[model samples]
Target chain A: MGQRTMSDQELVQLYLTGQEKALAVLIARHQDKLFSAIYVLVRNRAVAEDILQDAYFKIVSTLKGGRYNEEGKFIQWAMRIARNLVIDHFRRGNKFPTVTDSEGNDIFTYINIPEENQEDRLVANERDSKLRQLIEQLPAEQREVLVLRHYADLSFKEIADLTQVSINTALGRMRYALNNLRKLIEKHNIAL
Target chain B: MTKKITQERIIQFVYGELPFEETAALFDELDNDTEGLDYLESVAGIGTLLGSLMVSPSKAIRDNVLAFSAHFTEE
Candidate 1:
């Protein structure tokens, strides 16, 4: 079977045995979800890219050092690393990530699906940036729950375990997040 | 008697985290409740919007990572 079709565990084994592409396959499989998950929390493209790169190096280091315990999903482990890095960024900045970067650019665009025209692309970018700002405005806890559940691809139970809360608490936070986002959209009249 | 479908349950249903049986149960319970259905739509609607907002790392960044992986053992 092709490495692309293999399970993550199988890929890890192949990567261990000197197949570099196996590692590439694994990164391709999870990068979008992982990067997007981090981006949502950190709220900046440049910083998210940095965290993702650092997370990749950390992931490679751990795998090479024979320290990764493959008891759970690989993405979950990577998610934890990226998450801690984002938290570190928050501590360093002494606040939640601002929506814009140093030069005031919000360059969050999909990796695939190229836009047809500059006007349409600009419009979409503006709308998406507005939505992300609204997301930034969510209460931190609720936003965390939303990112963990939606972007991290974690179940509410997994989120509860990660966040040290009950499943009900996680679920409640997600519900609040959705409702709050709805209100934000209405209040701001965001097109999306 | 129908169990009242809570927003939390709707949230799970919307996210596809709810089990099939439970989803069918909620699907049935929500069939007659316009407000519940609308709430489900709102949750799902926002989720779709959020999904669209996701961005990918630039190609150069990914290439750099792949290169890092390629020579990781040699370094």
Candidate 2:
């Protein structure tokens, strides 16, 4: 099989063996999810993009510096780095950006959905946009849990550790996220 | 003895975070209660909808990261 078909672990091994393209392949495989996780927190495309690049740079340096020892969790490690950068950015600024600026533009504009039919695609896109809006409407903590769980693909335990909350709190936030989303779907009659 | 099934437990069950025994217990409870089953379906459906949305950084970001990766080599 080609490098395209290699598993993440295989790609990491290949990169370690001096095949630079393997690193490219691995980044391609995870950029979207990593970017999404960052955007969910920063809510600004430009800032998220910068943070993603910085995170990738750090990831490469870590790999080269022999500091990255996680065998099959390169993506998770990269995500943790990106998340920390985002937190630092906010902490330094001492203010988190609003979910949307006065112009109401947000990262959801970057979502690209694929579907077979034009009508179905439009409907699906609308549903997705509505869902995204609802998620943005969720309380910050709830949205953070949901984003970390789904976008970052972190476990509830990891989320608890990262957010410095108990596992029950993390799970509770996820439960409330779902419940609130359900309420919003019903309230708005969103067909999903 | 049976444990009470809260929404938190249902969320854990939906996300595959529950232990196998708790999962089995939840499944048993759901098998007996239509409302519980429906609630689980609703939660899971929202999850499915959330999963359908795909967000990515712009092409510029992807290209920049990939280009940087391509040029880096461990010395």
Candidate 3:
């Protein structure tokens, strides 16, 4: 089987057994979602990047020290570390520079639709940008639950554990998030 | 008592969070309830749309992490 197709657990095992390239494969597989999860919380690209690097460094150290026991839960384990780092960043009152585009507008204010995909790109991009903006408008609690569930690929139960809330509360937040998004879409007549 | 399917339950159902029996029951109800089915479609659509918002760390960050991990193998 190609290294790309290996499961996260399998890759970790390979890395542990001295196949160093396995580590790179594992990181590549999860880098987007993991980084996006941190970015959503931090809302600053540079700070999120720093937190992501720190999280990866810690992940390597833990794996090397044989301290990682989660096996198949590598992403979640790493995400928890990243999440804690974000919390620490907030706790320290460290100010994150606002991310802006070339026009000096907040990056989150408008989506930069990628031009890679040809057909259906325009409609898809607009819909995506609208949905992103609506999500950004959601209450922080609801948005966190939504981001963790959708972006982080975490279950509501895991989200509850990470966010220090009950399972029901997590479910409730997600429900509210969707409901709010639906309302926003309807109110704005978003065609998606 | 048959659990009345609320929006919350619909959310759970869409995400496959309902228990097997509850899921079976919901599916049965969904076969008859056009509104429920539409709601499910909308929620699922939003979930898919959220996929476009996924962001990756810059290549520089990836390289930094890889470089950092490289040291562990060297040691």
Candidate 4:
């Protein structure tokens, strides 16, 4: 290919056609988002990192073998792989062990603060950590709907399609998620 | 010419999940009912907060992803 950048679909096509550069580009493009999603599920940096590697290896192998057919969906497919790896990691008793890295410990511990202005960057980070904690409190079904809808930016119809639920059910789950979160915030006196 | 709206329908209204006629009717109800209006506002606030819940990965996560990506580059 020329200096022109390729779309995810094009990269996938090239990878399927035995181009090594395509896989690298695709991995480079999605590595961060995939890792973030995996981190949410697994809650451990090292484990999430390990799972990301497994996900990339699987993605390259599957694409190169022509096993993945959906176009423009490389990230979603890679995320599915990463998610499965995280689930398997948890199933196998994976644990975080307290973070030893000073920077890692600081970021992870910053979740405990309350009453910060959104205009401040550090406060914005605190808000994110609070939201993640709120999500963890949600029931699994509702949590899944919230993550798929908000984080993945999947439409309700797309989520229903992915989760094999009816559109109405997906909407209802989101409704419940919001209601439950509202209750949790009130009960815990969590400042938003 | 309007049907009474319930709290349950407020979410669908705010999120635009309702059909056009229902949305119009809900707005009409809001104009006449203070309680419905308050409920609508609360639900909207919840939606706003929930919508902001996407968290950026922590530094460790960033480092891990970068390192993991580099491995693919190396191999």
Candidate 5:
């Protein structure tokens, strides 16, 4: 079996067995969802990068120390680790201290959108930026639920269990998050 | 009598976490309820917008992570 498709569990086992590249495969497979989950919560590229690094460092420690016994998906386990790092960040940083985007160089904002003229793309870009700003403005609790549900793909029950809140609160926050975003979009007259 | 849709069920329904029969039942239920329909549409739209959201950490950060794995040379 020269070229075998490895499951996440197999990749972890391979990495444990000293095949280092397996970890890279695991990271690459889930980077989009994992990084997006952290980025939306922190709302800054640099901080998100920091939290991601911290989360991965923690993952390495736990796995290498023979302590990672998480059942189910590796991405879910990684997502929880990332979310915990974000929570710790907020706790340490005096509760959402208006982080400025020092690394405002997301390559996606460059010539990314295909099949659109410059003017139309520019309008869409403005709308996207506005939406990002509104998401940033959301209360941290609301944003947490939003990310866990939309990005992490967690049900409200799981979110509630992790967050130590009632399922209703989780659902309520999600509703309010969307409603607030909708209101902000209307207030700014930004069309998506 | 129409079933009263709680916020919990609506959220589950929105995420398609509800069972097949329950999902169909709520779909029909939501069709008759404007507020529920609006919530469903609102969240679905916002989910799409949020779905487009993502950011990649710099290569340096990812390298640092991958490099950490190399430190473990033995099983």
Candidate 6:
């Protein structure tokens, strides 16, 4: 409470010790990355923002009540909270989070492609469309792994830890994802 | 007679999941093999472009988050 510069772990300690502002700092530190994670799943900016706020509310109340473990892995714990909220939102909306659209279309279908005649630009656009379509075609399990691993920048170990899958299992899903994408590309003759 | 790399390994490599040593070997292979290099570059480019397509949340959304969090401090 006295302007003490604290590490995230120390901040968590302050929150547990009844200093509320410390909790605010912790939330601010994580909000952007956490929101980005939620947004990628929900793909709805408003919904992601809402979930982020709700996550903080839950984190604060839960921590102040001594319900949090001080395992020094507080970011991951908060991430778990944000992940649950995203899942709940999906369930409540009845839309599979990775599916983008209920009709099996890639959500990026609405993405506007800027016009350009350069060979590089044309190829890049074609590739972008193919990639989105391929990702949409992936099984939900594989898609989740790819998104969390690449888009969210989670390590394989972190992904396994978060998803509760073994490391090899996570890696396997990623493997299937790539194979499936290649197959889809070949099958569709998408000129990437 | 070229060995086939699984689509999974290709994705892993594109996403930077391959081990450093494996990556160096893959890089060498890609440099010497036109087909392999083309395929990898295409897929990696697609991955990059798809991710860049999303618009960052607007300022209104950011303000909403700030407002909501402000409730705790306003007390």
iRMSD values, candidates in order: 2.1, 2.5, 2.8, 5.5, 2.7, 4.7
Model 2, A76-190: lDDT tens per residue? 6777788889878887884445344344544345356677787777677566656767887999899989988888888898888778899988988887888888999999898
Better model by TM-score, 3 or 6?
3
Docking class of 4: incorrect
Task: For residues A83-178, write the lDDT of model 4, one tens digit per residue.
Answer: 677668868886533342443332553442343663465654545555667767788778877666555555676668777899878878887887
- The superposed Cα distance between candidate 1 and the true structure at residue B14, in angstroms, equals 1.5
User: lDDT value for candidate 5?
Assistant: 0.74
Model 2 whole-model lDDT (C-alpha atoms):
0.76
Give the range of the ten consecutive residues with the poorest summed lDDT in model 1 chain B. Answer: B1-10
- Reference-based lDDT, each prediction: 0.80, 0.76, 0.77, 0.63, 0.74, 0.65
TM-score (chain B) for candidate 2 is 0.71
Point out where model 2 deviates above 4 Å. Answer: A1-10, A69-72, A89-111, A117-119, B1-5, B73-75
lDDT of 3 by residue, A116-192 (tens): 56445655545554565677789989988888888788888888888899988998899888888888988878754
Q: Which candidate comes out best when scored by TM-score?
A: 1
Could you give candidate 6's per-residue lDDT for residues A9-87 as a string of tens digits? Answer: 9888776676657765776666556766666566555677778778877776676555776573676777788888888
Task: Name every residue pair that clashes in candidate 1.
Answer: none
Winning model by DockQ? 1
lDDT by residue for model 1 (A108-127), tens: 44334356888777666667
Q: Model 6, which residues run further than 4 Å from truth?
A: A1-33, A70-75, A96-134, A182-192, B1-13, B28-36, B60-75
Ranking by lDDT, best first?
Answer: 1, 3, 2, 5, 6, 4
Tell me which of candidates 1 and 6 scores higher on DockQ.
1
User: After TM-score superposition, what is the CA distance of residue A166 in candidate 6 from its true location, in Å?
Assistant: 1.8
TM-scores vs. true structure, each candidate: 0.89, 0.79, 0.81, 0.65, 0.81, 0.64
lDDT of 1 by residue, B28-60 (tens): 888888888878787888988888766667777
